[model samples]
Target: MNSIDSVTLEVADPTAAARFYSGAFGLDPSRVRVRSCEAPTTGFRGFTLSLVVSQPGNVDALFAAALDAGATVLKPASKSLWGYGGVVRAPDGTIWQIATSARKDTGPVTRDVDELVLLLGVEDVRASKQFYVEQGLTVGKSFGGKYVEFATAPGTVRLSLYKRRALAKVAGVPADGTGSHRLVLSGATDPFSDPDGFAWEPTAPLTVAN
Candidate 1:
């Protein structure tokens, strides 16, 4: 099964960015790599990192923590058509969405955000979906040529694809621009970029005996 292992972000200050992510969202600092990058003069338009909590209270708490850690709130936490979620911009300019499903009694709030989902904004959702399937990922839930989600093994980050314009709206960013996505996904057997330019690199592929 196909699964996302890690995500790398390009930022001006790797130390500060890593600190904010680890402290605010309880993400492992080791999982987040910091790299030097030239200042991006354009607005972020392509992708978003998502945290999927099992409960609404966790979403609310995480949203608050993100703001406290110096992230700018793009959309306040509230119920939406998809579910309860809020959008925020990390200090390094990465967009994030914290969301939960519509379920009664979200349960106790935890300080740590455990699960993650990476949403890629692609120019062609169908094409991107087909690409991942060819790469050996099984399709989970998909919508009519607009959105598709891939099933991931336990403890791996889930991946999904959506139309670029639609995703930009969801991320509260403009739909037009060009630059590096400033992100990378590892754990695949080979390094590749999707139709939208999101890079996926091979980490440590499983080895089998001859």
Candidate 2:
């Protein structure tokens, strides 16, 4: 029943990040940022944090918005022979990838639940394990001690976590946003929820649209 609404990347500029994300994810980059920030501050349940900003900057506004709001510029924007992308360091040391495009959208589309996994590195694995146990979850298995996964609910998707070192190894890239942080979700799981916890209940049953 649980689902993902949005996966936020704390960027130097929400607009730039959104633009990069929109072009990359094929979503419309039409955000009402001032409205989004009018609400109360939130914890990890929904979004990681709330961003507050008023207007867009320029044709280069995406970069400007994030920078003005305190996003560090990691890479400058440029038209690569391969693709269009630039990297920026977020306020919290998270690397933000602003790409005009991505390669893979090859899909045999289907109806299912999309599990939004959060990759967190906690100080104590034992304490983290106990916390989830209290939150109505059972730790399933450790992926070679690098990760420990938990189930969302009965027959639900698995939300997994891993140490930074191990995650970097699995991702085959540095733990820097220069690459991209992998929010590893089960490809076999259902696509069910959005960021608001609203059900995106696909009317049709599971069928891969090729």
Give the winner by lDDT: 1
Q: Where does the lowest 10-residue lDDT sum fall in candidate 2? A: 30-39
Q: For residue 115, what is the lDDT in candidate 1?
A: 73
Which regions of candidate 2 fall more than 4 Å away from where they truly are?
A: 1-6, 27-115, 143-145, 153-158, 172-210
Segments in model 1 whose C-alpha atoms lie over 4 Å from true places: 39-41, 103-106, 204-210
Candidate 1 worst ten-residue window by lDDT: 201-210
> lDDT of model 2 at residue 47?
13
Could you give candidate 2's per-residue lDDT for residues 71-141 as a string of tens digits? Answer: 66655655556544445544433344344332333344221113223445443455555655554456777
TM-score for all models, in order of appearance: 0.89, 0.37
Model 1, position 23: C-alpha lDDT score: 83
- The superposed Cα distance between candidate 2 and the true structure at residue 57, in angstroms, equals 36
Residue 142 Cα positional deviation in candidate 2, in Å, after optimal superposition: 3.6
* Model 2 Cα shift for residue 86 (angstroms): 17
Task: Provide the overall lDDT of each model, using Cα atoms, as 2-decimal numbers.
Answer: 0.80, 0.37
Candidate 1's residue-wise lDDT over 13-124, tens digit each?
7778878887888886445556667745367658898988877788888898999999998889888777788899999988999988855445668765667888888888
